[model samples]
Target: MGIVVVEICDSNFLLSLNIEEIIESKYPEVAVLFNDCLGFCGLCRLKPYAMVNGKRIHGKTPEECLEKIKEAIEAELAFYA
Candidate 1:
């Protein structure tokens, strides 16, 4: 399988989690990047926003987005695995 890249932008604690660090530490095959804006202002206004493999996810809290991202990533991984 290929690398799974999760791009997060302009979030509060979600960005603070150092997602890149966490992903690199736990799943070396996964690459996480943090940016300023994802060009989805509506979603950004929701606070925690992330792009998992090019799919946009917006939520009120980091935890909310994190759960969804994990599920999505796992599903994607399972497909290729």
Candidate 2:
């Protein structure tokens, strides 16, 4: 099993997702970390932005963002396997 970490910064929308809850529900092994600022203001301005394994996703809804993150995590796990 691999560890998944979600870092949320200044983005209010991202914070609203309650990422910890979602990750724990779906990916138990995955760990989510909420930070103050990822320093990606340009992307944050787009709203509902997140970084999935270091890749930036901009202007996403909570559901959409979670889906993308899950997909990325699955892909990472597959690579390890």
Candidate 3:
């Protein structure tokens, strides 16, 4: 499969949940990047969200968002497979 870029804002709540470790451990092919600012305005401050292969994925809670991110990653990888 090809590389799946998962971009998350540094201030996102997902970081508090060790999202980087969780994603890397679960999907070694996924490159999770934490940037100082994703340029999404104030979205990061209100909810859990990330960019999966350039597609925005978000949820009301961190756990929910993480699940969505995984789904998006799988979908993106499927395109290569």
Number of the top TM-score candidate: 3
**Tens-digit per-residue lDDT, 1-81, candidate 2:** 326566666654766767778776877766676667888765665667666667666555767776777787788667766
Model 3 segments more than 4 A misplaced: none
lDDT of 1 by residue, 1-81 (tens): 237878877644577566666556766667787788777766665577678789876566777777777777787677778
lDDT of 3 by residue, 1-81 (tens): 339999999889888688988998988899888899999999999999999988999999999999999999989889888
Residue 15 accuracy (lDDT) in model 3? 82
How many clashes (backbone atoms < 3 Å, residues ≥3 apart in a chain or on different chains) does model 2 have?
Answer: 0
For TM-score, candidate 2 versus 3, the one ahead is 3
Better of 2 and 3 by lDDT: 3
RMSD of 3: 1.6
Which 10-residue window of candidate 1 scores lowest in summed lDDT? 10-19
Residue pairs with backbone atoms closer than 3 Å in model 1 (clashes): none
Question: Which one is best on lDDT?
Answer: 3
**Ranking of models by TM-score:** 3, 1, 2
Model 1 TM-score relative to the real fold: 0.76
Predict model 1's lDDT versus the native: 0.71
Q: What would the TM-score be for candidate 3 when compared with the true structure?
A: 0.94
